[model samples]
Target chain A: MSARTYLDAGGRAPLHPRARQAFDAATDEGWADPRRLHAEGRRARLLLDGARESLAGALGCRTEEVHLSAHHTASLHAAVLAISRGRRRIGARVVVSAVERSAVLAAARFVADETPAGRRTAGLPDGVDTVGVDRWGRVDLDRWQEAVSRRGVALAALQHANGEVGTLQPLGEAYGHARAAGVPLVVDAGASVGHVPVQDTWDALAADPADWGGPAGVAVLAVRSRVRAVRAWPEDEDPWFPGGVSVPAALAAAAALQAVLADRERADPDRRALVDLVRSSVARTVPDVEVVGHADDRLPHIVTFSCLYVDGEALLTELDRRGYAVGSGSACTSGTLEPSHVLGAMGTLTHGNVRLVLPRGTVRDDVERFLHDLPEAVAEVRRMIGATGL
Target chain B: MVDARGLACPLPVIRLAAAARAATPGTVVTVWWTDPAARHDVPAWARMRSHTLVGTCPLEQPADRTGPSGPQAWATTVVVEGPPAAPPD
Candidate 1:
């Protein structure tokens, strides 16, 4: 077998060189709690403050607006619950795009169901008012306007870009509709923050450090001062997150963010071209396959396709045998073999789906090799399933 | 008639493909599938192989759950038009 190539880089990017350096330096110095009064605590405080400032500068938000959390899902839950709770007087309803992360949808559902009015009307059409999306996974702005304009919506949640399908949402218009309706929009920028340019299109933004070559322990949640977030959890010294995150991890995440951003102008175009190639190549070579995202308006590093008459798990196993690690969006690949809600929401084929996310330092030849092997792997899986001679 | 009611993705399509290969032209094969993946794949397979997909609708969940109709399966009717351009499966 050839050398193993890592193409499943969605939330598993290898740490950036800068992140490694930052982590090493911060580990020894930032071991103490920032809230403590000792000399060690002050050193840790400086690291945490510096990390927040750099992240704030990157996100175009005030340092005070930025808060560290345990992970991306934690940040999203906090944003959705806290913001919705803060504005409960307006209404307990949360307007969210259908294709937002499951965490966002679950958070919205929880906030709606937890309320007194919601308990009575839970699971009703008015509960967690969900806006639908197009076949390409773009949320319908017209429906969005109507959902947010409804009499009792507290907040809205939408992802900046979908990580699974790599489709970018029209945030400017989505945010505008919510703003006009006096609703705060919480944007999950996990998939777009490092790969694509961050747009000023959210009232509350939750970014995933792990998505951008940072460690997995910390995530960035920035809430604009104007946005009301009624601390959902018990009020502690740190209102945003009770225990706080690893200061060293936060610093390393910041450093990685800076590194990826600095290299964006040089890196994104190449990544985009490679993705475009992957998209076209899959469509051209593989029969009975549907490339599921918008061809033009998508993330620079991710692409997803669904193949008919093949099992995703089998195909992934075949590719693995061929020395390539790719991601899959199929029921068979998921431990429970449950269908993907993302694909289901788009009304796209959810079986035999393959997802490839090119890491920061992905090589061209490996991609070419994967493209060459994909047709055979797909064909083999198809044949194994008695779907041959097509 | 093919009842693919309980199987997930490739199985439903594979069963339907088997039916198409065995049947002569003008044979109408009905497959009832409950898995969501088959909802898209069955139609796609029909279109790809030139089989005629007559129509589809939700199965009234049996008043009581029982039997091999894959679980909440919908009935998909397809007419075998002819052999596909490629070699037989």
Candidate 2:
């Protein structure tokens, strides 16, 4: 396969040709609702089931364990709402990392505000609590343990790896903490699934195969049978999803996961080298740029840096014009600017935050081009900000 | 001058309010900040309080030069000319 160019892995990577072939094949089939039980529906069901099975096999879980959803955000909302409904009899506190994806955070807030006045608030309900993360984006385990030690804490959600900075969390330790406290843990593996091994410690795990070279709009929520969580809505009652599932996308997700895992051993080392190249080059090329994340204990394919005196929006735009389709708060949010929450949580500078997430089969030439182009981009942004003296 | 650097949300605005009250009429007060939200927030704050924004400048380099991680790193400096009010006693 030929190497395609992409500077933004957070949004979408250029689809691997083989994965693209599989995706094209999967989408070619008619869009029959899998629930109809008719011939076409049955075929859709078969594709859905095959996807669940392949995804489950790749993750080393049962086929029945996988629940497909539209995207990571939707899966997170469903899981949070499901857990909240199930644990309503107990309490409504949803302990989560302060730096969790905004989708999950917003859902928790919605539960808090919309639930009945006399009822418990959505997040850290009256008796519940929220925990803060450390500079490295790891939940302060000691603090989490302290919070969970208090009785009646119902549910906990933490990401397996941070999305922006790419810092891997202490999920195994968190799993032990949640287990010891008798609280069910929901791990958001959206950023970690195929890149790293997800511990079976989670009561429910949320992942997106696209993060590992899979198709978009397909995500999984793995709920352990031992954990009984009711769906928060009528639409979420399907057993296959424990909530409703998207069958076709699920099939594609499963295929993509299988492909990525099979190729991981060969791809990871190369990916890591690319990450290192970006990290080292940024440090050397851009003066006053702070590289954020756990330098060693992080996702092998992601490297993030914050360039001082440069507006993130301007920097991203310049990079885009230079043929590097990079991501920034400026681009993602359409220029209604704010510093990245992940960078803010890590206590790093956020003026010009840029992340380099390497797609599979990323080549030496692409990395070199990015390295050569990025410094100029940063310098241009700095000049525009009138801080060239620095 | 108001030192709002390292302060989180709302605090910078709060400090700006307090500084505005303490300044003499038409005196230019610079608010040093690192919060990205401030570019929008500070101007909104100045407008709300009816203060004239004289100019805005990036803190080019600290009087004491240091690495990026130190005090010299941030990129925004907001200058607000105070309203017609006497200095706080």
Candidate 3:
């Protein structure tokens, strides 16, 4: 078989050429301890500082605000916990959008469970209030504002974009609401940092390298300068030191982010057009499909759709067999196939789901071929499952 | 008993709730669901319907036989001690 066109950037990104070179160089020269005061340590610290500055520049924040971590999930856990703890005196509640990443949800559950027994309420046992989303997977602003404005909310989480459906959240509006309510916003930009523009409007931000063709095992957590927490990290421990992320990985991530951002202005239009091609082509060719997400307000690189009466896994297999690598967020079981919470909240069909994430520099030819092949894949899967209403 | 092993949320709870409604009082019904959300949804459904959640046992099955993202499936059993306070209108 010939090479397959990889379209799963949400899962893992193909590293950029510059990122690979930077990784090699940094690994060769940055192995010393950055905490030491020796000459070698000074050199290591300089590299670390440079990486932080580059990442901070990408995120539109000061260098001192950036803290490198081993993974985006860790940063999310730590940030949410820290922010929640910082406001513990004011309130124990943590407000979040219904479609947040699993890590955020898990961390919220943990925090709620840790609340003192005397402070727990019946419906608010977890002290976690979830704001719902619209059918397009975008946060419902009115509902979100109401949840954030609740009397005891400590922190609120809203991702810049939905990794599953590619819906872009209204970060500015959310930030305003959070500010008015005296709550801090923690924005997870893992899916949008390298692919689209990001801002430092939130009180905390979490971004990973995998979304922007950077090396894995490194993520950046930027907490605004004045935000301090007594329990976010142990008092004796360095805030960024969670077993120490690889200096080389951090440098590579920073380099990849800067390289992507530099070309974003020139490349965004073409990238958006390619993504639109997928959206349009899939709709035109595939039968019984409902195109998901906000067509105009979504990420320019990702699109998702669902087919009625079809099995998502079967369709995914057919697409893979046809030399197109895609992803599915469908929850299908032989007994009762369910869609993801995002689709479920939107009340959309969950079966035969397909999420296509075009890489930073995807070729038009491959996208065209994928468009040409997707209909047949869906049809075959539909036939295999004996689905009607084609 | 309902085997919801491959089903996700709302589905597992839906099936289990239906089984509880149809079952005789004081009978235990086992539901096998794969989605992690079922762990919460199932118990919540039982509580809302005034049923007793006996216990849940995690199923150890191979990943392939499970859904696409292979992981452990939950086999939870709940006992129905009374009828639903109000049936769907």
Candidate 1 DockQ category? acceptable
Candidate 3, residue A371: CA error in Å?
1.1
User: Residue by residue across A129-186, what tens digits does model 1's lDDT show?
Assistant: 8888898999999999998998878899999999999999999999999999999999
TM-score of chain B of 3: 0.76
| Candidate 2 lDDT tens digits, A64-106 | 8887876788888878777766777666666778778888787
Clashes of 1: 4
The deviation in Å at residue A386 for candidate 2 is 0.8
Top-DockQ structure, candidate number: 1
Q: How do the predictions measure up, each by TM-score?
A: 0.92, 0.79, 0.80
Q: Candidate 2: lDDT of A87?
A: 72
Give residue A65's error in model 1 in angstroms. Answer: 0.4
Docking class of 3: incorrect
For candidate 2, write residues B1-89 as lDDT tens digits: 78877764434555665666666667667678765655544564564456765545666656575556533323333334544443323
Better of 1 and 2 by DockQ: 1
* lDDT measured at residue A381 in model 2 versus the true structure, 0 to 100: 73
DockQ of each: 0.40, 0.09, 0.04
Model 3 lDDT tens row, A303-365: 888765456677777888888888887765323344467666665656567888888778999
Please list the residue runs of candidate 3 whose C-alpha ends up more than 4 Å from where it truly belongs after superposition. Answer: A121-126, A232-237, A333-338, B1-88
Candidate 3 lDDT by residue in tens digits, B58-88: 7777546645555577777777975333321
Which candidate leads the pack in lDDT?
1
Clashing pairs in 3: A333-B6, B5-B32
